[model samples]
Target: MENSSPLVLMLLGAALMLCLHPLQAQIDGTGLFHDYYAKSCPKAEEIIKSIVEKAVKKEARMAASLLRMHFHDCFVKGCDASILLDDTSNFTGEKTANPNRNSVRGFDVVDNIKAALEKACPGVVSCADIVTVAARDSVVLSGGPSWIVPLGRRDSRGASLQGANQNIPAPNSTHQTLETKFKLKGLDVVDLVVLSGGHTIGLSRCTSFKQRLYNLTGNGKPDPTVDQGYLKQLTTLCPQTGTDDNQTTPLDLVSPTKFDTHYFKNLESGKGLLITDEILYSTKGSKTAALVKFYASHSQAFFQQFAKSMIKMGNITPLIKPSGEIRKNCRKMN
Candidate 1:
């Protein structure tokens, strides 16, 4: 056993490296390229943009829904458009998952975009790629920073009901739980804080935050961490008990429709709507809290980091050519 110690240590280190390699690959953005569809579908992006713009113009919240759809799709089984699949006799879709259910909307918008793309290029653009581009466009359309979206991702044949429930962080998740979920997806503290900026534009339902306002610890008292004034407002918007579970309140009360740094500012002022959103700032002396403070003061830094993080999130194990097919319809496998 004298010399076996060194050999054992080396083997353990090698195994650790092997485990980390796949996570590194998830954020590498290697096979994706900026001009992937330049020749294959010269009008692919333009077609998606026109359709998304039209839909968002008609209803501004559609922009946030599309952005969230891409996030939901990427977190589960990679950015393969698996969230778009509907439930069939043989398959159970992610739409009814715990985190999604009534929360994730904008499938109709995705369907409309898919229809126009099939006509313009005919199987040249993948549904996965279309949603990814639409998400970026949504950010820009909502007055957020812009970045060159990488293309060439294909669709997943199967949607992951379990993956959708587990991978995506919940509004009530603890600080550590939120960190772990992001880490599982190859994200860091910065990514958690920045990508959470997506909440800057979206709405959360009453059921999602009732625990905080009504019975935080089963003591029939609201969460003390939440600002009292803001808590009062939320109480009015979300009753302690009602069938208004579907009622929505903006995640960011300030500049709710605009994708900006106000989300961080809200957390700083204790106006964040979701427990998960406010936890980034309220966790006390953590890196997540520090990043929240930084973003609150420096909007430019938040935008730059946000663009980089979005690209990283988009690179999550995409199904490139020959692995996943380009679905003729985004809602059903073909």
Candidate 2:
């Protein structure tokens, strides 16, 4: 295989090119531009994930909430500036208490970055901006996204749990359904496939896969081609029974530990473990083969586009100042 590092760097460089696009990124009122997401600082996103993983492990419901936020933000408007709080409740509802989990307090990671920035630039940035920045940063850490994004956009007061519930896509949605839903948010097939890479870092509860593992009546269950040994292990661990949501599975196939092109590789190998993942390749007209080849022949190619898509996602039309209010808490408002 071609050396991976140079290719990835080239992809990253291209992603950073977006900052220099005609949009004119504003950094401290100066016309000068910087490739914000070009390199480094994606650790903030990883920190949030680390926290979220803990949250999920500690409490699924709460972890689900954070997961919902990440997905909602990423899918709706291309991970735009609006996902984090910036406005007051547009609708009202009962507030549910969040169970104890570290990631639920995503602020932990955001705050760290804020503190670092404050020392470096002192109030030149906003938490709202930090959260978005951290997201792109996290993508890079996960071996994706390299585009620079705008900063200084203030936070909002709106972060509704119910809205999140309504916006996030389900695990079992078909390609037609998923494509339609993603389109409503201005996303495309490529964005959907790439962002789904988030699965690389998270876990899937047995509840999400039980139907695929056991209840299928026809070809609904595991494919006949799956390794018999692997098939037996799944049965032994998840055994079609009561409340098996406790079992977890990794989303990445090769080098699951490192967030790389392995996920695409997995799809090529028919090792996509999730029903949603399996669809990526099995679905007709998908770029699965192309993405896999591109990443292998040019691993950086994936990250570059992934990064550009991420910045595009983050730029989603946010309800901004004078148009929205800052939510005291992220869970609910209305």
Candidate 3:
């Protein structure tokens, strides 16, 4: 009986391992986890959150900028921090990409977070992970839904200026173009609608959407879909010919600082600041239109899906162990 007891215990242990394998595989498939830095740098998330909170407190708009960094980085090279690389004599980076030039602020805030992390656990956390975590913290600070951001992403040694320009959807992109771009990244239309909710707290420059105010379709008239009152307001903010091209407007006029469904609501009212934004609801026969209406009314559903879509966006083609290095300085490869 004693000899048989050992075998019985061994069989039970094997069964347990088999049962847990799928769950473990699911978590490890992307080579990322909720507590990736728990052992190596226990205070990784704490340090990041604190720095982000400080920056956001100092400038509320910084929250949206930080979140935008993660999206821009992920879309170009799968959340590898390629967007952080500065231009060098021998190599050009993505900073000057059309989608990024004069836009995408918050580099200083990221530098602050990275500097603190290095002091706490030198060479432990990756810049890519810092951007990702800061994005989540940004959302939380902005009164948006929070989720466990899977960490362990590594920084790419190089940046792709071309990819940055091509992959990141332009503000004037058509609904089909936007849908195709997201789909190419393994995201669907729902992800498209939910992820666009990030605009809930950001601002857009006049140059991005001025065409709609002047000549949306080669005609010297504003986009007809634009609410006439909103169009008048936009023209005043962004004149037909002036230096206001660099001037800015909140993406969501209603509660621009808050991360909520106000962006979707704005779309319904034809007040969406960008053509890409309005097209989500205004595009004829677009599935995104229905989603816009649904999210506008159901704030909780929008919040939940926004969180999920963010996670999905963060999971894009990450570089794991033996793939990339942990960049010491986010702007330059280590």
Q: Cα miss at 41, model 1 (Å)?
A: 0.7
Decreasing lDDT order of the candidates: 3, 1, 2
**Cα-based lDDT for every prediction:** 0.90, 0.52, 0.92
**lDDT value for candidate 1?**
0.90
Query: What is candidate 3's lDDT per residue for 107-170, written digit by digit as tens?
Result: 9988888899999999989999999999999999999999999888888989999999999999
Worst 10 residues of 2 by lDDT: 94-103
Candidate 2 wrongly placed segments (more than 4 Å) = 1-69, 74-107, 111-124, 143-145, 217-220, 223-229, 285-297, 325-334
Cα error of candidate 2 at position 67, Å: 9.0
lDDT of 2 by residue, 1-334 (tens): 2667988988877887764553454422322223332233434333444644454455433332333344455443333223444333464321221211122234444445555554545434445455565555455444554566554344444444454445556666676777777677777877777766555555555656556566443665665434466566666767776644577665553554355677776666666666677677776666654554456445677777767666555555544345443333333222
Worst 10 residues of 3 by lDDT: 20-29
Higher-ranked by lDDT: 1 or 3: 3
TM-score of each: 0.91, 0.65, 0.93
Q: How close is candidate 3 to the true structure, as a TM-score?
A: 0.93
Clashing residue pairs, candidate 3? 74-79
- Could you tell me how far off, in angstroms, the CA of residue 30 lies in candidate 1 after the best superposition? 3.4
